[model samples]
Target: MRVADVGEFGLIERVTSRLTYGPATLLGPGDDAAVIAAPDARVAASTDVLVEGRHFRRDWGSARDIGHRAAAANLADIAAMGGTPTALLVALCMPPELEQSWAEELADGLAAEAATVGASVVGGDMSSSPTLTIAVTALGDLGGRPPVTRSGARPGDVLALAGRTGYAAAGLTVLSRGFRTPRLLVEAYRRPEVPYAAGPQAAGLGATSMIDVSDGLVADLGHVARASGVAIDVRRDAFEVPPQMRDAAQALGADPYAWMLGGGEDHALAATFPPGVDLPPPWRPIGLVAAGSGVTVDGKPYTGSAGWDHFR
Candidate 1:
């Protein structure tokens, strides 16, 4: 049945009923507002919005995938700040004609992804709209550690990354070109795997600066560079592009390096560490921080476009 058939409160009941939460959630659904425990007495909060045809396409992913992506996008931001996600607030706005089942599936996806990080959806709101939109706000615990912000990189710091890059952008190309590629690549575009632990791990290791690679690696690193007032020189040979990304790029007669440098939504962590600091297992050195400005590839300026922008 359509969402209009059940009304907002009834739909909320159906969606919240299927979720499983933890002790962090003092008061969950069916409350005026969710009360979640902030163990460190400090919470790191971030929000993300996904709009139909802009952030995603219904034809490209199921409601579940859309929800998962929404959760990942917001949670990764928390992780980027060296925090562990504790709870989430999701708001859904959709056309009245949208199916109730779709909303439930979206809720299920949100719950499952949040559970991966031991977080729960504490509260949210629903509204009728002309289109589908998902807005997720994530709250995290820093565990008494200082947040790893983009402004901390030093001139002699080493740049590193945790998790894959360019896979999602390549996946988008594959689908657009109608090329038959590995399911993993396509799924990468639909459901990104964020490195949830690396952010905190980096903080524990004295990372000078950090950010989730939501935008392209170079683009996101540029944020760190500009904020820290340093130059980031990425070593191209350091990147180990998976064969799937290469194959997908070849199919479209496009450069895989472009995707690696420009693709966003990978949810990987890019961090800057002291020159001699030992990086944890998940972190791999991909570049170096120097006294300058902007991001460069192998000591040269990157000429390609700098990742996704909400507006031109």
Candidate 2:
């Protein structure tokens, strides 16, 4: 049925009925809270919210994109803590005019993406709203290891990152400039592909502190700096934005540096490690851990937008 032709609950019924749950599920769906097990590991939890206009644009993305993104965002946060995602509890709010089919498709997308990280959606809540909103709470297990948080980088540690940056911001620039959304850029904007393996990799390699670069490389690393009580430095000349990004920036007449330095939501893994710890390939070393209390790019103070804020 068309999106405008169906109401919400009807769509939810269709989606939930189709899932193939795993053996790990103690309780699945139809519950106020789903029970899960992490008998041998510590449970790590994280939550995130996406508002209609602030977080997504329906005109630029499908219902599937929204579901995938909302789930991915929460899961990445859990991963940043050096945990493996176990399950998710989703809450959704939608306007009365929304099609039930849209919600069903969204659920399908969420379920599929969660499965990619070995996670399942065991329960959820729904309500009517003036516009679409999504809240996802993700739970993970630390596998007998302590959480790798945002406060451990020490002097002389190596600063590195796994995964690409600037693609989403460049995508946004293309959309705002009245150009057709490039398929890659549109996908980047819709569902940021997080390096789910990087978090555990960092933990295994004895990373001192780690954080996901959701809010640009420089800005998010600053979060690590402030939290760890150390200074971080990033080398701009060593930075590389993908070719597609350079082309997109040219098309939009914008500086790719701004996006690379300040763009958010790419969900890359950034961490600091002591000497001789072998960082896996593509977790490119960007700079060194310094002896101060903030992050600097190219050995100097970076003067630009740090990242997003609730009130700008």
Candidate 3:
């Protein structure tokens, strides 16, 4: 059945009933607002919107895949701030012709991803629209630690990355070209992986600055470089394209390095720690912060397009 058959409130109930809240929730859905625990006495919040034919394509992914991608994107934002996600408020806008089962599957994907970080969907709003849009607001706890913002990096800091990159962008190319690669690469494009634990770990280890690689490595790092007023030099030799992406690149005759440098939506954490500080697992130094400005690939300015821009 379509969403129009059940109406607004019924659809809300169906989605909310499927989600399970944790101890962090004081009050969940079926309420005016959710009351969640704020042990740090401060909250880190980030919101992201996924629009059909823009952020995702229905034909390219399932409702569950879209839902998980949406959740991962927002959760990574909280992680970028050095906070542990506590809850999410998902606002779904769909056309009346949208199927009810699709909404249910989307909720399942959201809850599944939230459960990984011990978070849940507290509440949200549903409305009819001419197209599909999902807006997710994530709430996180800093655990009494100061947030790790993009502006905190200093000269002489070591740039490290936690989690893989470029796989999603390669996957997108594979899909666009109608080429087939490994299942993982395609799935990476559909539901990018977000290293949830690495966020708080970086904060605990005193990360000077951190940001998620949502809009390609160089583009996102450009934000850090611009914000911190420092130059970031990424080592070209330090990158090793995943074997699957390498094969896909070969098939498409695409530059794997471009995928690594220009790919986005991987949601990997890129952080800077003080020089000589030892990085933990999944965190490896890829570059260094230095005086000056802008981002450089192997000590040279990157001239390619800087990741995704909503307009233009």
Select the stronger candidate by lDDT from 2 and 3: 3
* Total clashes in model 1, counting residue pairs 3 or more apart in sequence or in different chains: 0
Per-candidate Cα lDDT values, in order, are 0.90, 0.82, 0.91
Error of 1 at 14 (Å): 0.3
Lowest lDDT block of 10, candidate 3? 175-184
Best by lDDT: 3
lDDT of 3 by residue, 180-273 (tens): 5678888998888889899999999999999999999999999999999999999988899777878878878889898888889989999999
User: Candidate 2 regions off by >4 Å?
Assistant: 1-11
Model 1: pairs clashing at backbone N, Cα or C within 3 Å:
none
* lDDT digits (tens) for residues 135-230 of candidate 2: 999988887788999999999999988877787787777776766567787688778888988888788889899988877888899899998889
